[model samples]
Target chain A: MSTPVTSNPAQEESTVDHSKIKVSPEEMEAYDQSGRKPVLLGFFIAVVWLLIGTVLGDLSSFKFDRPDLLTEQAYLTFGRIRPAHLNVMVYGWASTAMFSVSLWLMPRLCRTPLRWGNLAVIGILVWTVGLGVGIALLLAGHGDGLEWLELDRQWADPLLVIGAAMVGASVWKTLAARNVHHLYVSIWYVAASYPWFLIIFLAGNMPFYKGVESAAVNWFYAHNALGLWLTTINLGLIYYLLPKIIGRPIYSYWLSLVGFWGLALFYALNGMHHLIGGPLPSWMIATSITASIMMIVPVVAVGINQHMTVVGRFGAMRYSPALTLAVIAAMSYTAVSLQGILTALVSVNRITHFTHWTIAHSHLGLYMFVTLSLFGGMYYILPRVLKKEWPSRRLVRAHILLVGGGMVLYIVALGIGGVLQGLSLLAPGEGFEASVSSAKPWLLLRSVSAVIISAGHLVFAYHAYLLAFTSRNSLTRHPPFYELKPVLVKKRVP
Target chain B: MTRILVLIMGAMATVIFALVILVILPNSMLSDLKAPPQLKQPGQQELLGRQLYISNGCIYCHTQQVRDPVFTTDIHKGLGNRPSVPADYVYDAPHLLGTMRTGPDLFNVGTRLPDRNWHLLHLYQPRALVPWSIMPGFPFLFEHKPTAEAGDKVLDIPKPYAPSEGVVIISKEAEALVAYLISLQHNYPAPDSDALEEVQP
Candidate 1:
């Protein structure tokens, strides 16, 4: 007979009787695993980045609330840290964690050991330093003053090329040794995103597109880097996890193929919508709008396929964290995407353009949808990759409740704030300052939302900390799977 | 199992989307927007100047629309317009719905910088032009190839070119962007007589 091993280290260490425990050979072998330590260490680093991203976000939000709050400091001003918050969230937190996960998971998925462990380490170091140096350049007032590509031109080129090299090499080796016939959807997305971003990046920021083309090129890069680079990777996670969690085949493999091509073709041309009224040519704007509108095809197709796969899965939403997160992400696809289409239209854009409404829309897409999906994917993947269960259910619940509640408050408040501000500005005879004053209350509400969100993220980092450091032998053993009759989900209609 | 919850959400989205496009947009666009009246095009010289303004990336820093009433308080700041109208942009091939205002919106640039020579001097050195202007000067826009052992100076605006004198003319691309800028006007209502005929016609 064997003693039950505890995966929760905190629980094991706190117990009074160490002599009472007997560890099985399987538990001993899992205990001997060295890969778990680095994964935990990587998580701690990710936590620190999360704190920095949140603080920067909160600090920048304060500038909107109090325009002259610490206005004397040049580096601490709104403009500098605004890009800093974005980069830290985009590059530091999301990119770094995704890199860490891919490096760890790809080898396991391919059933081969990582060839050059040093390359992964080098990649993390280079990627981190690039984010720091680029942000330092931005705060020092050397930024190119373009959104997303706001890093100084001097640092931007090398940073782009070097960072791409690191991620590319690691991903290449992992894919080279494949154990399975089918390359998972996540692999397809993660693989394509690296080269795609690398090409689009060099084209936009090589200091070649100087005059009239620079503005056009900058918008193009800003939209795609987020869309094709980040969003596609997150979507890959949903395709895999949503099916896996429910223990079902995907609703339609053919729909998956259609969604893939539809996204690739439509997303690249969609950037021009951001330049709606900008002096870019009508043909360009019309093409972008058509592309933006055409995006509905992929969104609806993917949405229905995903939905049909999960039909009658409402009970799982109560039990499975991954399913809940993935489902919300799927829902956000429709909301933010439709918002993107409407905003791209010129007449509707007349009010929404240049307003905080765009920022709200951005959050719904980037934070609520994309990042949340990644976080959800992490909940499932991190356990298997590290070969350890979570230390506590309570911390996980705290993370879910806080972040979920916090974002809804944030997204809703900003939308209202933007709409009110937009209406007052459009009001006849109203002066600019007066319209601004009317929107101040909403801006104040937004600041409060930022505070709540930062708190939620802090709680999330804590939960992630517990998950990483805990040993598998310390977890109260769970049944690998409970036998159940599979419920039939509906097939999608043409 | 299926997403019974999200199906309701899916149904809700279709309805909300229908309401927004069909009901919201048409009512707003069809209403009396009371924007400033349409202005005539720049004289060919100014049209040349406006094209010069655009080619140089001036619009990156400057916006043409005061903010929408629903968006900001800037509606009346560029006074004589309520919210800008679709008719105002009828001639604009590439609509310039500029997002930022790093510099002032030039919706009424004609009124703001009416002096012809001022526009020329400003293009040469914007800091000298506005005193408070943060904009960089377009020294390259002016023709200034150096002579042997002599300091560089602008090749004068144009020379009555002959065997006697040497200077290159400014390119038409530069002139076009600037003419577009010089053409911006916030105060030009159609005549009462012209309005009635056009409305009827």
Candidate 2:
């Protein structure tokens, strides 16, 4: 072990002895080896989906401005392509990426070699095939038609369930054999998400419910998929990555406790807020609205915890690319959650429910918060797993700036435009065309932002390919688990 | 050991709690709802049209629900006769209560614009009727014919939208989709239990 070199008293005060947290190289190697094939396979497939999803997203956004561009083919039509973009991003890119991250995170947190790693590999393969077939069926005009549940229920959804079960089994087995007696907060989140997702997925695809009841179940499943599945897992990643990068423990364990239970309790009820003033019982909508507001408890708890953890270490973000993206994503979690609460209020939902503002809000939550978290996890995980430095630091910087900047522009432009469009619709004297006109210029801006974001995705994808395939084993020694260390600023003797 | 059990069980209990409250309860509560006397189950053609609408992903752009007039201008804006109630949609399977209104609400569209020909032209080329509209034309849903056949419904597309050599004829899919759109009339009186009291402006 290396000696602790302390050059400044101030720095010494803040820096903990990381030696206590460091694992034996052999143990880490065992963990990494167990996860290697599954993680890489999952990541490679995820990148392909990311690129495909980006192209589809760009086409869909462009269609909003110029709907005539791809009218020659039925498959390329805006309606089909729009859902294709959504599914590919949510299930294809985000889901695969999250699964890969979990494969790595679970082993590390459990202090055990991953059990049944082959199951995960098979799971990923099955998932990829299912998603591909599902997207094809959608384009071929055979969708189930529920938003966020458009995949063919009979053929496609069954495969996804089977694939997910295999993956979940592997993770669960690893957790069961964990060396540690106590489970971490991250494990709790990851463990919970599996069952939560299974319940919702099955419920969403069930064929029995008809009419408004189906709509009720649809939103119920859709919102929980976000809250329980995506949000839950990504929040777990944030909890693990934020402190690990900063070389600090989380600011408050109790806050994590509050955040977790608060989310599980509140988020499930928040779905019906989407149908406010629609064809549901007013009491149900009111319950959702109340639950939506109650979400502030979790959001604030998480926000404060993450903020306080990184309070003095803001300078660390300059050196670690992962830190920068993860911190931004952490902040976005708070921003998007707060915005969601406000949007759920009757006064705001009245205007925003059916407009482009809701689109902007979804993007904020999905792209800015969840997708960025996955990217940050990838940046940290790939180097350790592949045992090499990133091929090009410049490419990573380019991706961060392009995607981050584009998201800001996207949310602002579409958010304002959606408000204007909603107001126009509400005005008694204004024609329906006025709402379309009001949204036109902003839709054009959204296309521009999509182009920027797509360029970023391409840069990251190429970098990932180079890292996985072409990069030399330049890292002779194992890279440090955490990238950031306290910089001891020495006092100059007068 | 107990802690792990608590964590897993606690997590699961929350979801079950939500499912019971949000899904199962509402489902049972609304299960007994009967379609109003004025509401009719769509005919076979209209059902086929509904399938086409679903397959084509029309619900992504157009909504079928009309919000309460107190909260929205849905009624004043001529989207529906009354706010949509659970009874208004008893026959719909895989309901089309879409989230976005990129296009106008279609719940009462059959009542709003009853012309079959107009819907056909709009589906073939939306911009033909509404020039500034961003809706995609389902040209693939139509067939180009050198000459019209007997009993064929040929689309009279405007000058800019029309092909120079052939006339546009509606396919079974497009016709069904139009039938579905025309069958979306839910102007029936709301059930007393679900009706909102009129508020003085």
lDDT of each: 0.60, 0.86
Off by over 4 Å in 1: A1-44, A108-111, A114-117, A470-473, A478-494, B1-201
- Model 1 lDDT per residue over A413-473, tens place: 8787777666655565654454466556776787887887787787777766666655543
True contacts kept of 1: 0.03
Output the number of the TM-score-best candidate: 2
Name the top DockQ candidate: 2
What does candidate 2's lDDT look like per residue over A247-332, in tens digits? 88778767878899999999998999889898887888888999999999999999998999889987777666778778989999
**Worst lDDT window (10 residues) for model 1 chain A?**
A479-488
Model 2 residue A399 distance off true place after TM-score fit, in angstroms: 0.7
Docking class of 1: incorrect
For candidate 2, the lDDT comes to 0.86
Clashes of each: 57, 1
